[model samples]
Target: MNQYVALDNIRQELTLRTIPAITLWNRLEARPRTDNFDRALKAEVRDALWMLTKQWQMGEFRGDDAGSPVTSKIHMSTTKLSKYVAGNHDVQVFDDTVPLEAKAEQRPIPFTIDTQKVSLDIRLLMGRQWLKMIASTGNFKTAYVTKYAISIPDITDKNDVMVTAHREAWQQVAATAQRCMDGYELYIYLKSDAAHHAYDTIPMTPVQQDAIDILAGKFIIWYEKLYYQPLDPENNAWKPDFLEYQFGCSAPQGSGEKVLTADQYCDGHLDWYSVDIDPLSTTLGDTGVPVAPPKTYTRSFIPVPVTFDGMPDTRWWTFENGRTNFGNINPGTTDLGKLLLMEFGLVFANDWFLLPFTLDAGSIANIKGMSVTNVFGERYWIEAAGKGLDDDWNKWSMFTLNTKGNLGELTDPGLLVLPVTPKILESKPLEEIRFIRDETANMVWAIEHTVPLMTGASKRGSEAADELRKRYQQLLDKDISDGTVVSPVPVYKADIRYQVMNGVPENWIPFIPARMEGSNRSIRLQRAAMPRILNGDAAKPEKIRPRTTLLREGLDIDLCKPYFINEEEVPRAGTNVYQSYQRSRWYNGGVCTWLGIRKQTGRGEGHSGLAFDQTIPVKKAE
Candidate 1:
């Protein structure tokens, strides 16, 4: 068996360096260097350099202190005094998210799971030096008192000062408690603890439970005084503990009146009576039988000159000898004035009996059988007597004869019989022109007279009337696009007249001079050809011929003289000749066509016309 050494002994020998264990030590240290070692070392050096560079660039390590010092004083709790009073601490039993209900019910309440309950009070303390200063100053006293004298003891030591400070701070906290509790209230059942565990089990009626269930899951606040009741002393009746406690449910009342049912409320209170009842029964007695209404007749008679049978006659009539002069008649004293004078004469003559007529059964027969000649004779009779003739001359004569007698009644004793000349010309051109002008004027006057009536019939400033006025103005302005007017003149005459009479400026007319005829024709031709040229169909090869024969005659070959040409390799002949050469034996036989090169031998021939080398032996005529 080989001698064995213990591990502890070997470790001692190695530690003591007494054993020659260099090979073992070298074997233990001889690990092959892997790529990861270099990579790890490089990564460590990069990280260190990056950290150092970042620290230098940021200047974060240039501050005076490495860590901040604590400046606040530590508070020590004492078991002798209540922490609530000494620390001025208040415990909040309820927060805003807490659900408070008027009654208890089994319903899910979605209260916030992360509700935070914070203390209402915060600890406040003065420094020990400040407390000592207060002790030195002693308690403040009033200069004078009206009601009573007061005594204040001076502070002696730190304990007395501490006691006074604590007392004053507690007093201040107690004073602020009422203000803090102004809108706050806590409800408690008889058996409920400070955590309100018994509130969930309170007794509630079905209506109260239903109310709680209806308002469930809603974050709500309830005050204690609103629902709390106290026993009455006199009648032992329960009453509200606080009569003025306000419940904040401010919803509106129902729409219907309290005193009325739905139908009565809908019908309303006003009395209604039927309007179909007759009012005449009570107002008037049996004498109120409807009387036939009096007949209403329209006057229909106008004060204008009346023609035969009251018809408006436009026919112009002349007496046999009405006038002798040929000058233009005054328009004011023309036919209408004469007709008016004739009417006045007829009435006057009938009243004064200047002429007479006879009436009998034969006269009535003659009146009924009257002809145009008899009517004209009657008009002549009145004109000869220098009297006016009524439009109904026949009837007037018959009436005069029937009522007042005889053929001759003193025969115009007072009237003057002036010799009157008749108008010979009936249709003068100038008279017709004046008549047309008068008629047009009358029409225009009639239209203008109706404007006020039309405006009254329509609403004031209506669109219809405005459009009518606009169209009327356009008519007056003669707004025609085709160079025509209301009178429709010839186009050429109209153009000339419009240019001259309308004062049209020369610049306003788009004129092109006749001198540009050739250019304009060329432009038009080019315009007509543009589409064909753009479509690549300007002229077909078969239809078009070149203006110059240079290209066709191969004379345009001179145009290529500016380009460089190679002397060693000359170009071939024309395309047709080149193509023929390619098909012939010369090109196929590889003949050189270059300008300065010698021709080669044919395909079957050698360079010096020998079929093979002359030095080699050959059979002569074998």
Candidate 2:
């Protein structure tokens, strides 16, 4: 009976399972399985990851956070995901977000890079595309763009605006791509050019090179601030000496609004210290109110102008005791004035008196036989006689007086004056001969005293008379015999003479002539008569005025002699003799105050034969 019950239960269970099994079989027939499911899942995951990576790299994430973690709940469309999973290689991560079809036909436009404008067949990519910028130095950078289009504001119409905008947009894209490239060269991957999948490089234009150079200059300032020492007291070094740092658009002045594009600001302009930050309130602490530190600051340096004392004039005289107060006479007050004083001491502004002398006929005749006694008491015979007068007789009238003295007489007091003579007592015109002029005057009188007992009426048989007659005959042949009449016509003019004494006192500086103008004979006399100052034991003998021919129609004087001052030796005396000669030569003769300390002339040459301690009996002049 139990066995019969078990069989009935099994049959009932089998009958219920058969109906469900048939339903399952029908459902299985409706839907079949495929082998590519795992591959599809894997592809979907890969596509998702790629999209996430691209979004993160392009700064498209929330708050543009690249470090954000990737989660499974990222927003994605099923259709796009399916396309990637289906192995559609054309599927881009931004395919859905950006438009992929042309909204309108794009018209080509010319774009400027720096100063160059070029028309390119540039077209836009409707969808965002990836770009890789490879620097020449092997650095890599990436950027993304939705389209190649530029925006130009304030256009006349939408069409024109669109064209300009497209050009500008292209420039913006290209500039951004090239910003981090070495030398700022541009490299880009375009959607239109399918043959070049990799980034193609564009050479830098001149404008681009200039822009980079400016950028480099600015960057170096920052780099120096970080790595270099602005002031190192230990090494005695400092930053480059500059007045100030400037920051502004480097566009040329008046380039117009159109030329002042974005590229103009790449290089900064020069800044002057005049427009610097306020000196009274420079630092933030000094502002008294809280403020952020300036983004840029400048360092500047200014030097002070030099100041000095002036020089004395060439005609400025100082007594032997007056040298201690030389600082009293201010010299070289102005730039040009100082240069003149230093180069040519006190140039004569107007012609002035050179010596104290009268040019009248009686005075000229009186000085004929007189001797000029120098400070040394040495007598010099007066040789040729002439006079100078300007339009104003009272202001200027003097004689050209030549003297014949010993060779070594040009020391201490370098000048000679006719202090006392028999002719002076006879004429009784002035106390002393003084004041010489520039204009030449007639030779009034020369040595006309008859030779003692040697005139035409004297017996010619005596030996002394014969000798005197021979001399007189020789003088007559030369047309200059005493008593021979001559017209009162002007002969020769006089020029100033600069005589360098043999020995100069330690505290004394002689008056070196600046400009001397006259005949060659006058120039020679002026130069040859200069005393050569000696060093150690090498004493150079003073010059002596040679005996010249008597003046018949003109003054007879020597013309040849070495007159130039040696350049190497000129500086030792703190003067430029040759330059002085050149400048002073144009002026007529005049008396200039000899700026020197006068002293008694030494008489060593006259006493050379006497013993050092011996005294010689000398007869006094009556």
**Candidate 1's C-alpha lDDT?**
0.20
Q: Which ten residues in a row have the lowest lDDT in candidate 2?
A: 577-586
Steric collisions counted per model:
5, 31
Residues 169-276 of candidate 2: C-alpha lDDT, one tens digit per residue: 334435533232221112123223435322234345555445544443443343222222212111211001110111111111111100100111101111111111
User: Which digits, one per residue and each the tens of the lDDT, describe model 1 over residues 1-622?
Assistant: 7566456576668667775642353344556666467665553443667777777776745754322221211111111100000011121111111111111000111111112111112111111112222232332111111111111222322222211223332344345432322111111221134334211443555654444333321211222212221111111111111101111100011221001001111111111110011111222112222222212222211112232322222222213322332222343655776555455443332232111222211001011111111212321111223223323244322112111123332211111111111111111110000000112111100001011111012111132233333333343344343334333333332212222111111101111112224554321100000010111112331211111111112222445221111111111110100000000112123111110001111122111111222233233433
Give the TM-scores of the predictions, in the order they appear.
0.10, 0.11
Report each candidate's C-alpha RMSD, comma-separated, in the order given.
68.4, 52.3
**Candidate 1 stretches greater than 4 Å from native:** 1-42, 46-51, 69-73, 76-622
Error of 1 at 127 (Å): 66
